[model samples]
Target chain A: MLERALSGSQRYWSWLIFLLVLMAIGFACYLYQFKVGLKVTGMSRDVSWGFYIAQFTYLVGVAASGVMVVLPYYFHNYKAFGRIAVLGEFLAIAAVTMCLLFIFVDLGYPKRIMNVVMHPTPNSILFWDMIVLNGYLILNILVGWNVLAAERKGVPYSKWVKTLAYISIPWAFSIHTVTAFLYAGLPGRHFWLTAIMAARFLASAFCSGPALLVLICLIVRKVSRFDPGKEQLRTLGVIITYAMIMNVFFFLLEVFTAFYSGIPGHKHSFIYLFSGLDGYGKLVPWMWTSVGFGILALILLIVPATRKKEDTLAVACAAVIISTWIDKGMGLVVGGFIPNPFEKVFEYWPTTPEILITIGVWATGFFILTILFKIAVSVKEEVAS
Target chain B: MGVSRRKFLKISGLSVLLGLGGKAAFELLAPGSIDAAMEPAPIGEGKRWAMVIDAKKCLEKQEKDGCKECIDICHRIHNVPNFGNPKEEIKWIWKETYEHTFPSRHNDYVSEDVHGKPFILLCNHCTNPPCVRVCPTKATWKRPDGVVMMDQHRCIGCRFCMAGCPYGSRSFNWGDSREAPKELNPDFPTNMEYPTRSKGVVEKCTFCAERLAKGQIPACVEACAKIKVNALHFGDLADEESEVRELLRHHYAIRRKPELGTEPNVFYLI
Candidate 1:
């Protein structure tokens, strides 16, 4: 099945080549960071986690989105989702791959990553995160490939593969929850200290992950012989709509708790992010833009007419992805660090080299995604023919 | 009868667990035997190490010409290099304004002088240190006696401790720790006795763990006292007869962000 990926058209090959070039540049910068240490990045004692960890956090959610398709197909036995279950599983593989690369790049000593394995501290949420993420990745790969193989041969997927599919449903939820715990459990980081952190994380992840998947499905419809089906796309839009609403609602709860409590500790971080505190307004515009996009996503998605229209649905999906990306990828991590424990704002923005390395990781994820999707679509096309 | 190897292994594991359980039960029942666990380790004991910074004396020194003498001595001893960029600079003991150091406590009506001047700052070595609790590798841990100690060699440089710390005290070695010596102070031996850290490891005050092992005080405390101002006082907070306790008894000392309940060992007397 994977061999089918090697036989793509000229446009596909060129896209792969372009992504490979970006990866080369990113890999080169990572080497420089490896030699020079993390100094090449725009991180500081104040802002210890800048771009890399945030990307890791967001991708964990993206990896978990595969569950949305898996649940409906396996549990509810929805036929439409069954057609696209392989697509969701493949997306999980690519996202988890990138999630891993982001974490590797963020480590001050990438070589010592195995130390976590050697000295397994169960007290550290990061340890559990590593376990769940690896487990999720392996589960998806096995289930997605075996199921596709079974489909190609015109037979039922084996019992073991079905077992894995069920395990992956819950495992997907665990990965993002553990990632949320990584920040939520930290003391004195008031912004991340909310009880709703895990809930917020899951909600955003569900919406953003499926939104990105829908965008890809639209593209696949144009480029390949197989269509994921209109019903599948429409169902995904509904999932994204409800999830985005919950995500926004959860964010508002955070806002209410901070402001109503009037505890300067809790309120100051919100102030620092939305407005600026003590004259640091760097994240203000970005945060507002995220809010605006979130509102737009809700408007375009909630209205049945706009959502039913294919073009409008794509636009809404794009809005959801962009909005959630900025909120989770930029606002959440940086906002947590702002007004440092001392309640002073030390701003952080990714340096060019940092951004390039980030691009490299994203390209690497997409390159993997492109190949995996190509294989899945090719398999589907073969089955239909 | 000969037992199977698997059963034997299970029995052995259960024996170990029971042994630990017995010790815990005994500690709960008796006071004398529990005393052994409280003994100071060579690195430093947890509550055994603390610093009391006299803000008045520090302010006077700052008024004179900026007392970076303690900073220089500590950084030089620890081989902490100056990377020039704030984003990458490393510090062990340094000066920060009272307002910045105690922002939670800072208020608008407070005397301009109190929050205006630079105050001595370093790791609090909290009784329940968050950094120690958060390290994925146990690279940092709270000593039984009370000091928060770090094993730089074991640090995987994930910066989890940095995010966990409320004080912003930990510093990451973003570049070679020995660069300053190689570039500017070629004659200096890069503090050969103290192991200089490699890039990508998080390093901090360690409450001068190396000096404590040798029965000496922190470098900044010694340097401040040598100048005869007595601004920095390092002593055991666990001992009732200790000078730090006496200082606490006599002065209205405050710990940074006391509301966070970290129970910081470092106290400041205004």
Candidate 2:
């Protein structure tokens, strides 16, 4: 099935080559970072985590979003999703791959990463995160491959594959929940200490993840013979709408709590992100941009006529993706570190090399995604014929 | 002719689980073996190390001549790099103003003497250390003596411990310490006996565990005492008659962020 990816149109080959070039550039920057240490990045003793961890956080949501389709198809018996369910699983594979890569690039000692498993501390959330993420990645690969393989042969997937798909539903929730615990469980980071963090993570993930899948499905329609189906795409758009509403509602709940309580610790990060805390608001513009996109996405997704139109739906999904990406990937992580432990503001911005390395990792993920999608689409085309 | 792919995957997965289970069983049966491998010889048995900083005395000395003997000596002995940029600077012990050191306690109407006064700051070596709790590798842990210790060799430099520390006590080696410019750190590793850390590791004050092992007090305490300020005191908190305990008994003292429930071992006499 993978060999189907080997033969593609000139456009497909060109896209892969383009991604490879970006990956090479990113790898070169990474090598430079590895040599000079994390100082080459925009992190400091104050903001120890920067872009890498932020991307890791965002990608975790994307990875978990695959359950949206998987659960509907397998448990709810939604027939429309059957054609694109494998696409969701494949997207998860790519997203999880990116998540792992982001974590690796962020490590101060990438070589000693195995130490997490070597001297595992059950007390640490990071240990559980490592277990859940790797487990989720494996589960998706197994289920995705087997299901697609069975489909190519025009047979029902085996019982084990069905069981794995069922298990993956809850496992998807676990990956994001554990990632939230990585932040929420830490003391003194008031920004992340909220009880609603896991809920917020799930809400945002459902919206952003499906929104991304919608865009990809549209792209797949253009570039491949597999029609992903209008009903399937419409169902996903509805999922994205409800999830984005929940995501916004959850954020407003946080705002109400922080302002109503009038606690400086609770309010400081939000103030810094939105209105500049004590004259340091590096993320202010980016945060507002996210807010703008969120409102636009809501407007586009809520109207039935616009939602039915493919062009409008694509615009809405793009807005949701950008909004969620900025909110989680840029604002959420960096905001927690501001007004540092001593109530001082030390800003963080990614350096050139850091940005390049990040781009490289994204390219790598897309490189894998292109091949996987190619194979899945080819199989679908074969089955249809 | 060969094992099927599914069967091979099952066999490998089961073996990995078995290997982990076997290790767990070994540790459960003889926990001392793993403990002995991880911990060095205890500096003192059944002891809880604590420090008392006489903030009033320290402030008086600072006003008199800007005394920074404690900071200088601790950094030198610990081989903390001087990057000259606050963003990348490393310090095991340093100073912060009263407001900055205790942000929760800062107020607009505080007395001139207490307000804006510099306070010596270092790791609190919390009884319930968040850093130790969040370390994925147990690279940082609370010793039996109540000192939070960091094993740089074991640290993966994920900086989770940095995020976990509420007081910003932990510092990561973003750049190689040895490569620090001569003007900034003229005598890098001023004490050759102490090992300077490599790039990409979290480090913090160890409560001078090495000095305590040699039957000497922390360098900061020694430096302060030598200067006749006698502002820094270190002793066993478990010992009722110890100087630290005696100071706490006589003087009103406060630990930073006591409400957070970290129960920091370091206390300041105002």
Candidate 3:
């Protein structure tokens, strides 16, 4: 089986070459990040966390969304997801890998991350977050690899792998919920103080995550013989639609709470991000673009007529992915920081180094995903043979 | 009712995987067993430290300066860097604005009536603190005698306490603070009473835990006492007969935001 999978790898030479070149460029950017401090990023004293943190927040959602498939298939016995359960697991591996990269880049000294473990703060949500993220990543990798190995060997099921899948279901939810707690538990940041933050994060994660997976599956099918079937796509599409609806609902709830409460503490962040705050209208256009794309994506996905067509669905998924990336990722962290504690407005724009490093980290994740997906596809072909 | 081997294989395989994942999650989610090693000893017979700020006696133009003497003395004695940059300031104690530092919701309409009068601010050393509540690490904790103290070594620099602080009292060490003071000033003695803060750790006023340990009042309190302005006072809030408690009853001393339910030990005579 291993030999057969290796033989299948030979066909994708051009794709492999392209990935290598991109990786080379990404590595070059990363080299610059190491030489200079995080000062090169768009981050400032007021806006301590910027693009890296935003990306981390988004990717954690993506990683956690894998459980949507895991839970339904294992607990409720949804068989339509059978062919692609491994895909979700593999995708989680990639997503989690990216999440860690974003966090590492966000850290002042990536080297000091180990201090978090050696001198652990058991009471800190961040400490718990680290434990959960690392645990989830390992659990997914082990289970995914073991299951794939079982199929390849034509061997009977492993007892441990089954037990591990059950753990990963709630573990997935924990990763993102804990991520939300990192914000919600903050004192002065009124926008993030609500208990609904965890729910909102999960909703957005579910929406964008499945949408991204569906798009990837379609692309894989187009470029290869790995068609997951129209029915499977349709089923996942329904999940995406509902999740996106909830995500949109969660965002609207935030706006309603902010405007209705009329509290300066809460309303200020929203005004700063969406409209102009203190004559600085930088995020206004980006925010509006996100809203426009969000509505467009929701319309395309929710309506069966539009969602039924593969091309249209792909476009909708891509649009939602970009919008969610902006709304939840970029806008969320930066917005939280605006109209600083003193009610002074501080603006943040990503510097060239910040953009380059971000591009590099993103490319690195893609590079890993490319290699990982290639291996998975190769293994699946061997099993089918 | 017949199930194909292929279908059975998928169903059972998924069930097994699900169970394993749940078990793994349960392990990670389970809270760590409480560390019994670091249990606090019973409070000994020592001066229970507290502070009194005579708001009226504080100089109008030199409001922060009066507070600064205490802050500078304590920080220098304790080897804290005067990191000049706002970004890198590691103030164990400092002055704050009427809005941020003192923050009277009533003061919104009343700040003009009390112009040029800014109260001396420090860690409330709250009997019950919100900072301690949200702390994921037990780094910032209230001592038995009501002094809020920090274990710098244990802090992960997550700054949750900083965020939880309504007073905006906490400051994060954004850069290396140890690089300051060009020449090692001889007046300050460095001991491991608190760990040297590394970059990314959050720090705030300790209420001088080491001074209290050595039967001395906090450096700020001593400085205020020496200046003879009768503005700063310190005593054990826990003791009913303590000066701080007696002053609270006799003089209409008020704590900032008693409504927040933190029960701050620090009090100001308005």
Candidate 4:
């Protein structure tokens, strides 16, 4: 059974070789980072958190997006998501692993992680965040493995697995919520201190996360013989469309509050992000690009002709994911810190070390995803045969 | 064995019940509640450290030679690095010009704007400090006395405190600050109280906690008193008979950004 599952087209071998080369290059950069301090990265006093935190923020959203599949299948009993349920779970596993790696690399001393545990602070959201992230990862593994094993043996899935599935619906929400709390609880940075931050984060996560999953599913169907069908794709596309609308609405709400209140603390970030401030226009171009791509993706997904076509839908998903990634990950963190606490403009651009380390982490996620998907797809095939 | 529907429901119920019970038991046994209530041992008898700055008197002095004697002494004693190069400067104590220091919009009633006058600013050591509330690692905390402080080793360098501070007094060490001068002060050498800071972590004025531990005034207050400027005053804010309290009552004193509800310990008299 294992041998039959392992057999695939020559493309898998070539893809593996490409990933290995990328991984080796990334490893070399990581070795340099270890030898030196964080000085290798482009982070300075004003912009302390850079690419690592941006990746962490984006991956947490992706990890939470697993709910797009889990909720409909487990709670609503929508059987259309059944084929891709395991895919969502595997994606989560990959995303969470990348999340932890981003955190580990960002820390000055990753060895002292036990200090957080040894002397716990219950009031701190970071402690709760760590707890929920790890717990959610474990839950996915347990549920995904049990279901796959049951399908392989032609037996009923464990009853406990259903309960785990229901728990993960809320657990997925918790991971992103805790990530938001890490920023929202902060006092000084007005850009992050908003009450709607968590909602906005979840909205964006749902939009991008499911869009990415849908695109992957389409590609899988084209390459292989497994088709999830047009109805399932349409349902997922509609979900993505609604989520993107909510994400945009949330962003506009933030802008309205900032300008309406006339608080320099709040309004300054919006101005700095969308427009230029004091000749510091690094974020302006990127932010507008995100906005343009986001609107374009939304239109494509909504239009009947584009949504119906598999190729067009795939492009729309890719566009939405890129747009959301830029808005939440790169532009957001950088824009928040530009006119720093001192009202001084400081900019951050990723250095070679930062870019290489980022690539390494992304490669690591892809590697995990490849192996997990192999197991899931193989088991599904056995069930069919 | 085929699992029955009844058995599945029963198992699910029991597992959830047990999980909640376990969580409750863990909370009761945890050290958090106990340690939080346990207060630190008192520092000095009838002496809670405080600062009283006469803003009107400060305006009378020149910008360069102004009441900055306190700032100079404080930074030097603490081995605070002065990169001199504006791009890489790390200051524990510094001055803020009037426009930067005060809310320019608020003083609508006063026509004559004071531009040249600088306020010698540092951490307010707020009674209800916002920075302490936001720290994820419990690195920055308040002492038994009125002073707020930081533990450098425990700091994760997130710099939330720098953002939390409304005064903009806190600074992050972008580069190693130890390259400034090797000749250490005999009075207060570099240690945990004044440990050498690395790049990325947030730091600010500690109100000379080490000096207060040894039953002496803060370096700034001592230096300002010596220079005969008499602009900067220090005493217990809590005590009615203390110099800080007397000045606050007799003279019109204000705090920076009183609207923010930080309850700043450092008072400014106009």
Name the candidate that leads on DockQ.
Answer: 2
Q: TM-score winner among the candidates? A: 2
Instruction: Name model 3 segments beyond 4 Å from true.
Output: A1-48, A107-122, A153-160, A280-282, A340-344, A347-357, A383-385, B1-48, B59-67, B82-84, B102-108, B115-119, B133-138, B178-197, B253-259
Which pairs of residues collide in model 2?
Answer: none
- Tens digits of lDDT, candidate 1, B64-140: 97777788899888887877667887888887888888887778888877857788888999988888778889899
In model 2, the Cα lDDT at residue A254 comes to 95
Chain A only TM-scores, each candidate in turn: 0.99, 0.99, 0.95, 0.96
Choose the strongest candidate by lDDT.
Answer: 2
Error (Å) of candidate 3 at residue A65 is 0.5
Candidate 2 residue lDDT tens string, A151-260: 99999999999999999999999999999999998888999999999999999999999999999999999998889999998999999999999999999999999999
Provide chain B's TM-score, model 1.
0.81
Distance (Å) between predicted and true CA of B69, model 3?
Answer: 2.2
Reference-based lDDT, residue B243, model 3: 77
List native contact recovery per candidate, as a fraction of 1.
0.78, 0.87, 0.23, 0.21
Clashes of 4: 2
Higher-scoring candidate on TM-score, 2 or 3 = 2
Q: Over all chains combined, what TM-score does candidate 2 have?
A: 0.94
